[model samples]
Target: MAKLTKTFIDKVEPPAEGYAIHWDDKLPGYGLRVTANGVRSFVAQGRVSGKAIITTIGRYGLFTEEAARKKAQKILQDMREGIDPRAVNKADAAMKVTLQDVLEAYVGRPGKLKASTAAEYRRQVEKTFAKWAPLPIASITRDMVKERHAALVKGGLEGKKAAPASANAAFVTLRILIRFAMDEYRQADGTPLIRDNPVDALKHHWAKLGTRTERYIDRRKIGEVWNKLHAMRGEVQGYEALASVDLTIFGLLTGARRDEMATLTWDRVHMDDHDPAECWWHITDRKRGEDLQMPLSSQAVALLRSRPRLKLADGTESPFVFPSWGKSGRIQDARAPMQAIGEIAGRHLSLHDLRRTFTNIAMRECLIEKFRTDLLTGHKPASDDVTSRSYLNLTRLNEWLTGEVQKIGDWIEQQAAIAASKNVVPLQRSA
Candidate 1:
């Protein structure tokens, strides 16, 4: 046992290390401490009713022997009244877990997650943690999740892309992650990694997407707008030649998400053939099946041919099929082209709407076979089961989808031009 004094600290410097001592020569308990790389923490021990009680006083330099002694004395007093300092710390920590770190950890896990999924996780973390980061994660109560959720629901109504579906998705992923963290905390055998997960109690309460919100572009309007966007491909200033146009065309044609198209490679694509037997895009990271190769229409192949050669990040010549403007990874965004098209065509449209438009056309007009459409859109099959999803595939009718998308872009451009030339009546409808 060492004595506490400024002299003791002066002699302590990492390699030599810090030390602790019992308050008295034989005080029914002891003071314990350890130091590494100059950081230190300590705990004091005392016994009540023959049972021991240990209280961690905090870190070195932060708590001096005098301060630790005072704290220990206080704990001694509490123990005399039957209070356990260790139990108190456990209770206190259970109320201190916060939202920010948990969200970051959840998203940063090492795995090849889906493009839309990665995007979704990132978006939810950014949006939810911004407000709650300051709040202790454990302090986050069921009431808080509800309040935040309600605000988001209302915000969805007034949100930039007000879709209850999107709002519910954000909330659902957040709640699930937090709830998982809770169970993790309970069995924690370490330094109390997590106290409690605030969102666990409310898992069954999230508002359902379809029942809570319904919004999408109409099929005919979708066709009209998509054709216009397709025609405007690869021509805008910020958009690179083949990279930009080819990527959007793939998304429109295959009903793949933008990021999926951005990362698409030749290996994933079988443009040569995709009958009911052969596949077009054998997307490795898609949602439905482990691997799917939909048929490639002549439309999709033409777009692929237009893509310029690219070198992957490793300097290997990439048959990226749709090479990135950056030469590797994926395009930061396919939005620039969509924005340009909307501006030129004078219609306020989004790239994702093109995808939704495709889903609408397929469901309403059988634009593609039902099973084929589900696979293409990454949607669960009609039965939506594992076996049903196994049949999902990415058909290659790129040339047709692109041509159709171009036509849609052309129509939108014409509409925009008309609106510019003539005072087009604002089409307003009740939501």
Candidate 2:
């Protein structure tokens, strides 16, 4: 063993396999550890509570030989006093951990989040909060939240000003993170590590953003919307584009959410059953975290049957009803195609607009019961009264839902036919 210096440590080489340690004679417990992969780290070894303990100070380049020695001496002193350096180091690390660290822990917690939700949370964290990620979570203050929220509304983190809704989403994501950190992380004395959540200020901030209008396709334009979607399918080629058309139509007919339809799989679609009454689509993983069995209309079933199966590189078919060549192996977004159709219909629409359109037609035109529409849309019951939930048997209600959904499908088809007929020009004989 010899005195460890930058020059001395730099001279040390990793073994062919495993790792080798070089101790400093001047600092008994201070040393340099080199791994087979050529990683060099400063480490300290000492005895605490009559047991040997080794703690890594940091990497060689990140920590100088002198700094490593100083840190190692303090650790050794703590060990001599019956304090484990590793425990102290962990406590200190907990205090200095960044927002990114908390986010990673929150997202990675087993069974705490659905796959879709986890993906959204990750996108929000990496995209919206990238600047604040490295900063310690505890250092974030109410004033900082207010300024950042305003900045997001005025000039987004990505250099363009986001709308009130987009800014509000960022604030909500931050609020969730702070709340999770407050509950999950604690001090050694059993008190919360974070005394107050800065995001609470959002309660007041949200009022100034203004209430957003619910954007939906007008009922009068439903026929035009249907006609335009059909025209779009003819204009676009390939299974992917065609699949988007079918998915959009299905969304309008069934009132299913965009992700719910996009991520649908073959296993969940019950096209043929011994009992025709049993034919339905089984959405096992819905946003509300419940399984919903939606009865299929003839039009819906026809659309499903017409869809081409996508084959993978392994000579097997993909399970996704709307499969894509994308990394996710399923249709992630139909917004672009929906926007094109929206243009022809003389309205800018989102996938959710299709859902809203379905509900509108169901209530206003078809005169379907509100309770039935709520069930078809997978919405929670308005009244939590026990009697309201207990009296109706789900099996029997499926029959009613099946009929109601079929009515919606029939109405959409009728509208499409009316729009198609209107396009026909009558020829007049020349006088």
RMSD of each: 8.0, 7.5
| lDDT tens per residue, model 2, 138-255 | 8889998888788777766665634454577777888889888888766644566688889887777862432123456666667778878777768877767778777887888789
lDDT, residue 269, model 1: 63
RMSD of 2: 7.5
Q: Which stretches of candidate 1 lie over 4 Å from their true place?
A: 1-42, 47-55, 77-98, 108-120, 123-135, 138-217, 239-246, 273-279, 309-328, 336-356, 367-369, 375-431
Best by TM-score: 2
Q: Could you estimate the TM-score for every candidate?
A: 0.61, 0.68
Q: Quantify all predictions' global Cα lDDT against the true fold.
A: 0.57, 0.79
Candidate 2 backbone collisions, by pair: none
Candidate 2, residue 310: how far the Cα is off, in Å: 1.2
Off by over 4 Å in 2: 1-88, 95-100, 126-171, 182-213, 272-276, 286-290, 341-349, 382-388, 395-398, 423-431
lDDT of candidate 1 over 1-431, digit per residue (tens): 56655566556555464543334333334353555556555566767677976777877678876786677677777778777777677656655656665655666677756545766676667655467665666666778777776666665534543344445666677766666566544322344445555565556766554321123344434444445545666344433554665676666555667666766767776544433224356666655545544444455666665666666557786656655546344564555556555554444445565576556555565544565555556655555367644652333433233334333334434544664454767789989
